[model samples]
Target: MTVLTDKPESPFYEQLSGIVDEQILHLQDARGIFLLDKAHERYMRYYLRNVAEKPWNNHLLLSALVYVDKNADVRTIDELLQQVNVRLVDLFKIFHLSNMAEFNVETHMYQYLKGSYYQEHSDSMRSKLLALYRSLTYSTRKWVTSKLNSDQQSYFEQYLLPMPSYDSRDFSFTKSAKDLAKDTRKNETDVIVPLLPQIRAEGHFRWNQINRLRQTFLKACEQAKTTSMDLPLEFHYDEPERVGERFYFRLWDKSSFVLNHHDQFSASSLTSAYKRTGAYSEGNNRYFVEFVKAERLDDDEKAEGLWFTEIFEKGLIGRWNEFVDVTDDLIQQKRELLYSWGYGKNDFTENSFPFFSKHKGILTPSTFVSRNKHLAEGILFDVEPLYAAVTFGLLAVDIFTTTGARINELLQISNTRECIRKVKVEDKLKFSFYAIPKGRDEVEPFYISEQTMKLIQLVAKFLKEHYGTDKIPSVIYRGNRSHLFPEPKPYFFQYHESSFNHFAVGACLRFLLHGLNFESQEGKPVVIKTHLLRHAFATEAVQRQNLPIDIVAKILHQRDIEVTGYYSEPTPSQVAQSVSDLHDVISDYVDLDEAVLRSGEELVNELEEYKQKVGVFNNVLGGACTTNFVCPTKMQCLGCQAKVPQPEKKHELEEVIELSKDMEKRFTEMNLPVEVKKAKAMRKHARNELKEIELIEKYREEQKYEPHIQFKK
Candidate 1:
């Protein structure tokens, strides 16, 4: 056995006692190659130890491991390399099954490789596994080349196994625009729009109700004592109509017992007394219900209980039926009240009710009830964390829908009050919050509506109250790359659970949507992933709000306008409308005959031919272009007569005129006569287009009154 005691031995080291060399374990060249940081060092050490267990004594396998270990990036080590470790173990098992002494490139390995690829049912998994295999082969070649002379390296490279190429046509992994649009419509109509009002109303109602009950519970705790002479303890409800008239109980050393409305001993409701009294035990720790009994008040009360059996035997079931009806009516009234506030039938079921048997059966009393002294002092202990979580999720939905932030960006929102700030734009105050956008190290402002900012502030106020702090406490994020020396950031999307990550945020959103009982147009249950909200925001901006693509791109924090275009492509209906509008714009500019407008197909064909002659027909700033080929005028559409100025794009043309004037001034100062002349010409063309549009608008206004005045094109 090669005993190496320089460092602490890994748990997996025993499995590879003799097969691996001590030098390979102490290899310093691979330190920077694979992340040997505190977060990932253990995984690299374990991987090396585990790979050494392969029965075959092959230098090629050792070389491949070292090569990949040194060359892999942090992401590959964190995510994909784990899969590679498992696959390598499986490959080693294949070598044993084939009875091979070492890894042979020309023998049974190729057949096994081909069969493994074909065995995978998922196209994506197959692609991933193939990439890993190719990586191993490429790394092995590189490692061999570094260890050998040029002539020897070239000869060794030819014998290496070739990797199969991935097919480009298989795009099942990608989502199309149509798929995104469908998701947007479903989420907008079924969940996001409907759930907003419910979250606000229910959150407020539940918060108030819980606080009121909490105060009553605290008062009852102080009033009822084991040393007190009061035989029967009492805890009154704030609103008797919601729960019941009152709860009468007697707390003993080991357990507690309940008394019914008539002050008669009730065994069935004893379960509630046990739970409530357990919450109020000394030191606030739960009391075990070992023994419980309702003591007799006097001889007369005991005699009344004994007579109930005779009354039941004497055909007096009518009285029992009356009591059942009254109980049912109270429950029905409570259900109706909840329904009026948009709560579904499922929410009031036995599974959800805190006092019910089913709820108590699965959940411990401590799970829902808080025993924190601060919460008790603030009269907020009765509020379950679930209600607060729902409120937090509501804030998340509002931020996502309004600001179009990625889920990670939303999770990383700073809890500082200064996170939300106001800036004056064109003399109007606009609100935006600073957050770390995806793929960026520094924070940027994400603009939100004033309404959203108010809701966020309200939630922050409640968070401070719950935490008993002037400022929300900062906690380190514990997901993904956070393990690598993470600093604490006061992320806003957290609750009692300090380590809120992407999955927890996702679960909160899904829980709210599921409770809302939303369904899609096809009657299937609505499923809203957080990323879908980003798609909805983009689609709404383009198709409904009609915001410019570049403006939407900037708001979405995308550097490339073309990438934003994928998110905001026009639907078929919008494209048809745009084409219809384009036809009218073309008629106003060109002297076309009636034959061109007689048929839809002929008009479309003519438009295509006209676009070919013009240069480019796509919609651009200021108006739609008439040309099909690249513009020889270098997209100075304002100066080109081939461009049609749109009334909707008049604002864009005005901006162009301003830009032209600024350019002319700069060019003149620099003594660039030709550049200044071009700028002047561009400004003149824009002014002329604006004048023509104004005259057309004036004529249209006059024609509306005259009715018979025909303006020539």
Candidate 2:
């Protein structure tokens, strides 16, 4: 119903005209909003893929395109926009988008049908809709700005440069305790010791806030019944101290009065009684606090308090978990409650009526709070938070435990062919998770255990069922403004009740740890996070298991070995134990006759050269030893082409041959055909190499001048 008619004389108007010329603003659209054509849509997609990574830039563009007017004067446009209470991208998502299908349009009016059976969309659409909306807006703004002349650009900057901003309070949203540990160069022990308790307290605060709201709602319902009336649309209160007593009051500047009409004989009488409490005035200003229904709540008004309506006429008012009425109707009612929190509403029909929503004019004590938790407490956690915690909790646990992916990399998973692959592992069928890791340029698959694969499938199945789609929906993260492209497709981790993002991912892990009361190996409370799993993986691979650094780097998808070096470092105790063990191996195995040793220094130099050639360690022969060539296989050094024939080291070679034969026998007994084949080949190669070493030792023994190897040494 709101429209800007007739162009005005102003520099801002001229810019608007230029934007219209570029087809960025099509005021002729049904809602007097901008709509994208096929060509423009493609261009926007390209921009989103290549340039605009975050929604902030897109939001600014859309705010200007959707809310700005050509008729407004350049000098007053900023003030006018502020007065209009322009809706943020979050608000637009809640009310404007009914489902994914409607999201592409700039802004479309949605209606609720009477006696309708249409299933409402999932809450996850919030982020999806915003992403697409911002992409369009960002592309449009870029196009408009590019076409601007220097004078027009200067005018645009002066008028629109100061953007509307609000704090999101997302400081702890992205980084997990593990991520912080990596940045601060602290161990998990140090990080978890402090972070775990704080997050646990945060969780408790969140739950308690919800409980208070639910209790208050129930009490208000009881009061309504005592009065023989329907649910109250709004709650008025005097002060925090008297909130328990339920004495309703409204306060004016420097004065306050309680609503004393509850004892009135009839509903009409009570209405008439309170109607006289009109707007109070001081110094040419008058204002009144008005109550409205939740269904009609809009972004324009600031939220005052909650409204408990009869939308749930099923007479269901208790703990959310116990309620069996999961029908579409109940879900819609829940959406209405969220909308009243100044986010967005699911239904915006004319007769919907507000139960919980914002209000105009002066606010009472119950109306104001500093954080979203104050308004969100019971309303949000009641139906969806638990489900989210369970779903994403299991997801985070499995992904980290198995593949050890970074949190952002996990977010990149989608039920697409590119993200998943089936491969054989240890001779058994297993899944290979392929992804382009954070800060990396290439994609590779990391083989995960069967258990991890099953968990991933479970999550994928749930998403498919919940969205009712065969196609996989991609997970996307807005990055720095410079790189705005949507990640290569198929996002697997999505929230069922709200938009999925890194913040949600971290919260899920924290909530999971809180719920499980988990502790670390050091007996400290555990704070599970994405990067911690990465570090754990590296430590196990390079230090504990003695895998190669380059291989560890590849598994972690690191661009260089230096980044992985931090994680792969051995502890002081680990280093000391390794050195002690190596000393024992050398003293037990190295034996040389003084006559053949000729120069002791020459023998030491030869050993040093061999160690340098093999880079100091080779465990495939059962223990660390000097080598002059690379091992040909990933397994033990049984099949190494560069192994030296040392008669004194004959026992180690014999042990390797026996180990290979034993491994092959086990594979055959286990009926692992693929592994049996590999093991059989390794055993055959080890036997041949052992025979050659024995022949060389026999020849040395036959020649009395040549010192023979003594295996007993």
Candidate 3:
């Protein structure tokens, strides 16, 4: 057993009085020192043998084991120790260890601890020979669980996978050194510095200045990807450097350091928002009106407005009759009154801050989902206006929003996931929410799946990695002072999982119409928007060969058939593809050998017999045919050749077989491109040949093959 010499020292008399043999065993086993010491001793013995025999695996081990106490060689003097003096002198190259024994011990200890991994072996394997060594180390008897099983051994091995490899470079400090140079010149890194200062400059990133700089840097990133970046990169009131190499790295590194330093400033700003600290200590003890804040609303603004009633009344509640039946006029009237103070959408007095759609920023998968949830909860009143608002959102923002779901859908999904079931309605000040009851036996499940959940989770993971956990906002939303997810995020934004439907629709409309409400560089209305997706989805579904509208509706969750009908039905091309698939299946069935067909019949019967026990759907016949061989001919018994005996009513086996054969032939003919073309050509040829006697005789004979009739020529 591994001996732990660090055990508490006690008087001999006290130790003898308190100890029992079983208790001592338990201590050795629980403390785990028994196994470790045992393993170390065994390994040390093996190492010693290797040093004596191999002599070359490690020259240092050879010197230490063979010559430590011997006088054969002067070089082997390094292997010897004067109990303390010589060991100290020989171990460390740092600060002549000969001067201090303590220094040598520290150097040796440090080396022992700095393995590539902190804990490479498990407690069990550390002392495999515990039984043999326990007597030598301590007066105890102990046992442990059996050695780790295959699964457990694999688990431990996987756990150590993330630790530093032996070859891992110490780049953390090297990263910081270059990062410091970046901080000195934050802004103006893209463009060359002019000889004269046109305007007095401050270090703050104003919106206009920030916009220009963002564009400049985006160009630089693009240029870096394609061409050489020899230009000096600069930042706020800082010097530029040759940023061609490691363009993005030093920027992120320096930003991290800057954010770390500014954490106090951030906390203070949020705290001030909450407490109304500085400018609100007037005689009335009231926070007065100040500049309108887009990031935070004042006390008057915190009141969640009854947005539903206002927009619903203003021609917004036109789409879904489902909501109309669920909602009422009394609730909506109150919502309209709430909007009288001015909705956030039309108001631009806040210095042209984000005043469109559900919230600010480019249309993205994350933001779109959030917006969708907002709309569903009646945070925004109308789907129609919501559509228009999205036009503003996407068109105004620079980022592409088409990939995510409509913003309205995203919001509803988010609310479903986050809505705490029954008990309180304290959070939203003015916005109205419903209270849906659940049974005691039921547990509320999330509506936003992993696909949608990824939107916000990606944000948090990114923040933790680049900004550090300390810099993240305490809340998911930053509304009442403790804001979360601030701007200028340190990391490259992680990709979102949801579709940016609303954002795309909003942007496209603006691009096509050229800025309905907000000012835009492109004067015409934007062409794309979330609403167009409804059309796009319908058109694409209907035109795709073999894809049915009903199936597409199920995918899109269409409750109203009319909404689906607005999309055109399957085109001629789509029908052709469906016919093509059917032909392929029939071919496979026909090509099977006669014996294989018999085997298939037996298998089908067996499948049916097992269905009841297996809970298989008996209604579905196995694709294979079984023992029964229905005759393929379709003629009546007197005229049919395949039936053993014909039925009087003429539903004989021969008749059925013939009908089956004819049906297969007809379907097969439709599948053949040449046959289909020939059929069309024959129809046209007969129209031109109608005046001829031969053609007329042939046409009549074709229809005269009825069993009861004979044609007279």
Candidate 4:
């Protein structure tokens, strides 16, 4: 064995001194609310009460004290400590101790096997409590720091985190002198023992009865394995603590004990652990409570959150407690945790056990990804553009859809200049879609401008730059005039929120989980997932200058699902530049319909001359000159060929004016039921009148300059 011997300047003792001091202080701080101690206190109390025994020291504590601290060579003792034959604790004056039985004065002898080590537990004080004492309160000084390695210091601190709820004593012991005030027996003046505690109205245990029962249990359950189940433990008789309850054990768990959907303990686990290890189940067991368990904490046993070989030795006749195999217990725990989320072992890993377990690590991508589609995609993630696309896809879909749209839409170009002289959308721009859904005899259309067309060109360039490096399932976009979503692998992200969130949050969580070596998959982790991205998008939708929720919702396929909302609109600055860009396109083409109205007024001024021209050959006949009697000239048209310009209105101009008024009316409609046909007819009338006015105005303008036009008036 490697040993750090004395006489060196920087000796083992000096290095460990600070760490050990800090550890002790931590232990003292843990005196209250530590799960391990709380559990032990309960078991101890229960056993003691059941047996009805009063002993100075507990067997469990003695074993620990003797096992960890003793050095046999430095101290020589005549007393022989035969492990198989040794008693657990012996009286040293009034307090019971294990070393007193193994003590030898001759050579100042103390050996680990001879009782210089401690198991680091008290029947009442917990492992965490003891650890806290060791780390914080154990020292007289208020502050302590670690000189040990960082890992050791971390280990020291971790052991002290409190269980969620304080269940009081693990098992009640007979009311100790500290808990109850002394009272002399009424019949006998000299005899004194604490009275049974006053029972509360509720079923919960009172302090007196709880402590008394705890002690009784320890005694009754002593050597319980080879002995009867009816251990010598019971509460002091007092109104039964309540009407019907026989017992209660304090919870030694994390604060999340009361959270939704947890495991239930049958009280059998305590006995099973103790019987096997002579150590109660604590940190590595159900005792941990609410916090997510770290893989580092996975051990058959832990002392102050440090993994160690938990065994005992005493002389050649050894009585080493067996290691508690929590294999089945852990399996049950994992299954229970998964079940709460509506899944079974069959849902996750093929073996249903995490590949990177406490004892197993060489898990490869194949085994780790296994059958999980979401996980597999996540595993394939790199800094590649596809990674951003897939990961961003989640948030994007929530903000917009393609729920699984690929990058194909960003690639194609259309030459619209070939079809029309003036392109409705820019002729230079081409549009296509990637991962958009298709229908029979129909293809999804993408509205691309020059900017998006450029984005596709960039994607193509990028694909070429990293050609043959594609790790994805397949590439679909290549030629033109096609749907980007090709055959075979249809769904990129399956329809599940957990899978979506997993992709988002799992990025970070998986990384942290992996670093701590959790029994889960590990790779270059993405710290954020899709929903978080969606959350960002949602927040941006509400808080940023993005499109309104309704429009965004429609983009994300949520419009049909929502009800009426009249949210405030944004100022122009907040909108994406694309809206402004589209605005510029429209502003360049000011509606000529309004300008046409102005020209119609001029034509109306010369309307009579045009009437003469149609019949007497002066200038022009404007479809017999339809004129608006609804116009400003309406009163002066008594002998007019057309009293209203509506008489000569063409079909198209009428439609434009009608469309504008209908749009204006919709603003005030607000779910108001109205007849569509009647509304359409009124709109049509407004348009037709405007058109006739335009025609009459044009006819009058022609007579003003034509060869021999003369006004009838």
Q: Candidate 1: which stretches are off by over 4 Å?
A: 1-120, 124-164, 170-280, 285-382, 423-430, 483-485, 520-523, 560-563, 569-713
Q: Over the stretch 229-275, how does candidate 4's per-residue lDDT look in tens digits?
A: 33211222212211222222221222112121123322454444444
**Superposition TM-score, candidate 3 onto the true structure:** 0.21
Candidate 2: what lDDT? 0.39
Best by lDDT: 1
Q: lDDT, candidate 1, residue 202?
A: 35
Misplaced by over 4 Å in model 2 are 1-186, 189-384, 423-428, 474-488, 496-499, 515-526, 571-713
Expressed as tens digits, the lDDT of each residue in 1-713 for candidate 3 is 33434442222212322322212222222334322121112223443443222212122222222221121222112212121122222233434333222342223423422322225422222121121122211211111113334553343232111111221122232234334433222111111011001000110111112223233344434443455432222222111111111111111111222232344345654454345455222221211000011111223334222122333333222222123333556435433432332222222222111122223233211222222222222222212223223222321221111111232332222222123111111211011111111111112222111111222333334334433443333223211110111222222121122222332334323322321222112221112333333343343334522234554443344545565555433322221110000000001111123224345566456445443331111111111111011212211112111111101212232344455456556757678756545444433322222212222233223322221211111
Give the Å error, residue 503, model 3.
6.9
Every model's TM-score: 0.46, 0.34, 0.21, 0.19
Model 2 CA lDDT for position 597: 34
Selected candidate, larger TM-score, 1 vs 4: 1
Clashes of each: 6, 20, 75, 108
* Best candidate, TM-score: 1
